[model samples]
Target: MIVLLGITLAVVILVVVTWMLLTRRLREKYAALWLVIALAVLVLGIFPQLLETLTGIFGVQVPANLLFSMAIVLLLGVSLHLSWELSQAEDEIRRAAEEVAILRAQVERIERAISSGKASGVEDADGVG
Candidate 1:
């Protein structure tokens, strides 16, 4: 039983590593998860008894694969939500920048008008003297 488990785990790891390499999906962001999956598989491969003991300690009755799948799904959903928020923020920033430009133009025009008006105003020549 242990030998069979080891062989199965070895095959799974090889397949996963090959897939990641081929797809170029070995980014640092997902590195931890990959490492965890790798380590878990390795441990399970080399020591099925140990894995059983650990599972018993943790009171985890569900299959490891099912738990891993759920985690991946949750991570994907959170990532998508974050991406959506970032996109919304980007749009808001663009609009704010446009508004700032408009206000800056208005201010410049106002300053120019004020300066011209001041220049054109002649204090009564006597008063100026």
Candidate 2:
């Protein structure tokens, strides 16, 4: 009963991750990571003793401890990746804002020149005025 439940849960997770990828709700890289994780879960479910062997190989006393440690590391890595992406987005936004300010200043200058030229009755078509 427990083995069947574990397999079903892993399959469900795999389906959900694939659906998210197809719907464009998740990025390809993240989807790939999830797919790998789901596959690992499926393998672990099919052969529960694999986890025990892994724990022993890694010098861990309990399989649950190794699993929790891996989960924590994965979460930390994901958090770091998101932070880096946010920093890049912020840098891009700053550059875009600077460009907008420069363009706004140019537009304001052009408007002032046009108004002054009209008032002084010295309209130059080439804008040499």
Q: Who wins the TM-score comparison? A: 2
Model 1 misplacement above 4 A:
1-62, 122-129
Residues 60-83 of candidate 1: C-alpha lDDT, one tens digit per residue: 785575546656986797689669
lDDT of 1: 0.71
Q: Estimate each model's TM-score.
A: 0.48, 0.84
Model 1 residue 80 distance off true place after TM-score fit, in angstroms: 0.3
TM-score, structure 1 vs. true:
0.48
**lDDT values of the candidates?**
0.71, 0.90
- What tens-digit string does per-residue lDDT give for candidate 2 at 1-129? 777887998899899998998899998988888888788888989999998999999999999999899889988988999899899999999999999999999999999988998889785887664
Q: C-alpha displacement of 59 in model 2, angstroms?
A: 0.9
Residue 119's lDDT in candidate 2: 87
Clashes of each: 0, 0
